[model samples]
Target: MSHLVSNAATDKISPTLPLTTDQKRLVDQILAFTTAHVNETGPAVFTVYGDAGTGKSVILAHLFNQLQTASRTRPDSPLAKTTNYFLVNHPEILKVYREIAGKEPHLLKKDFQRPTSLINQLAKGITTADVLVIDEAHLLLSQPDHYNNFYGENQLSSLLAAAKVIILVFDETQVLRMKSFWTEKRLEHLLAHYPHQHVRLTHQFRMQASDELVAWINDFTHSQVRPLPQSVGAQYDLRIFNDAEQMRRAIVTKNNQVGLSRVVSTSGYPSTLDGGKHYITEGHFHLPWDQYNYTSTPWAELPQTIDEVGSIYTCQGFDLNYVGLILGPPLTLSPQNQLEVHLDRYTDVEAFKRRADITDAQELTAIKKQLILNSVNVLMKRGVKGLYIYAHDAHLRQYLGAKAH
Candidate 1:
């Protein structure tokens, strides 16, 4: 396959790959559960919970592939003649799955769809769902969003009503918007009403970074700051650059040597819904945010995408050889070298839209900060081989550079 057809990011989650031991066990359990409850009156749910880079996507991909194969090709199998669909909220990831469908015999492009599309289809009575496998279920809209044309109160709730079996992956930390806000407690309560089983995959499968380095990134996302782990420099190419220009240069070099490397950032720069470019500028470093991808190919896979800066929307659920992260203006270091979120500086207004459920000022503000940190968490885990950093705040950049020994 050509580089555009497959690369590190797409290959990591390819459906054709063999599953790991844990993944295989989970798949077996889900399949057994479906066999036992597919004909039951209530929906049978097999939820998979894992943080980013824990191989949730690939496992689901493999599981769905098996389901489709059994349903379409196996004559004597109990799952034969069953209908199944693979759903994901992320458009970029949906593109990858659709592309992969073209190369596989049992997988069909029509089998992959966005959650909103499926929900609307079921509501319109155009098609009925049987088994639905949803990836990144945390991104599902819990509120009625007419902007995306979803009029349902909760997406998963509708899927449960429509499908006999539902399988999904969830990561509370990956929740980005108010419309899709979810907590562990919320998920547990929802699952309580259905016949459900869950498994949590804690293994680190994406980043080549050391355990200490991974823990450090996790702590940072939780708004905790600590001295950099000594294993960073030697164990991974975790570098903190004083200049965004230099970091961009490093990322470009890595991209030339190994494709899938790009510069990404948090949401603190100038951005709007206008169709024009919104450039992110920092001392001699300037690049526009990733444009709306209209083509079937993913943005990160496009050859010219190296010139653009990726945001959480485009780069989530992706893998890179190296990622040069420009810490946007919303993030800064305090007097004690701790990270702080400057909500006033955040430009992504869509992420902080008013929610009828939230009224307390302090609670709303805290959630906004968590959303900012969650974006950072998504970017930090993208790189498979290395992670490069540059902060817009001078003091924050200096502190990161000094601690990145």
Candidate 2:
């Protein structure tokens, strides 16, 4: 509950303490480049790309620690004084970092802000920090509309203009909205005019599962038609249950046994708590999503949230010991024997809002489907020890059970 007093508080961001080999290599490279950039006034750009559990944030934290140490050793180092870190997406994630840092729970207000906030500051000539380190860069909006978007322009250019040394931690698959469509091609094109380095971190560090299990998870969520490898089946605790109550009970048991276990589901089911309905119900199983005002603690960390479900917005960019995932109404099996997504079933107004005018229904449908699939991918991969699934559609459940088993 203590607040960190300084932005350079590395201890708070040290959750997955030891960096994997891939992460360490990237951090070392960034540290060396940052040192040179500071001494010579050289402009530099670098991107660290990875999937959900690939330690992108971990590498950024390590880089921050290394830079902080260098600044301490060289008291006159400009990089130490000029560098700034920003977590653009997930306030809960910012809280987790603060908790890890163990000091700056209060100072996070200054340390963490949305990408748009940084742009607004730059436009107003608020601060002159040169090095900008961005976590959850995929959430950066290309065309800002709502969410307090003061710049009303592309965030990419605004960020680049704000800092000489640009370090972005990105995961392309986590792009949840249409306005936030930042792609590799666009990234490459932008950096082509500047000196930039692109590096990949592929090591699986968060999920305490094997490489095979990770691959299987990736394939399953993306709707890739691949048989679940027997080795992965044996090593990872993946289960498909037809009954949602059974899955919920198992998840509760898992939480009591090991902690850090919670239930998460798609927003396909409507949240009726505001309408005097305490729980979301289907057949005999029902649970409520975390209260909209549940802001004191991160959803996955709190013991009470185990009774409330989490969605992609609540669980992304964080890891858990176990996850009970419910595949809601949006996802189903088509007559062609393929995975189909129903956009109407999804009730996340912000996610499906037409930020840009698109007249074509087909185009809108395709985009919505991709967003749903991405959400499913994120929710399913939150577990470190195991994943328990309950598919709402009977056919999809049968299909998943057959393939996963």
Q: Which is the leading candidate under lDDT?
A: 1
* Positional deviation of residue 174's Cα in model 2 after best superposition, in angstroms: 1.1
lDDT of 2: 0.70
Best by the TM-score measure:
1
TM-score of each: 0.96, 0.87
lDDT of 2 at 117: 69
Per-model RMSD to reference: 2.6, 4.9
By TM-score, how accurate is candidate 1?
0.96
* Residue pairs clashing, model 2: 3-103, 3-104, 3-105, 3-106, 4-103, 4-104, 4-105, 11-101, 12-100, 12-101
Q: By how many angstroms RMSD does model 1 differ from the true structure?
A: 2.6
**Model 1 poorest ten-residue lDDT run:** 1-10
Residue-wise lDDT of candidate 1 within 133-177, one digit each (tens)? 999999988888898898888898888889999999999889898
lDDT of each: 0.86, 0.70
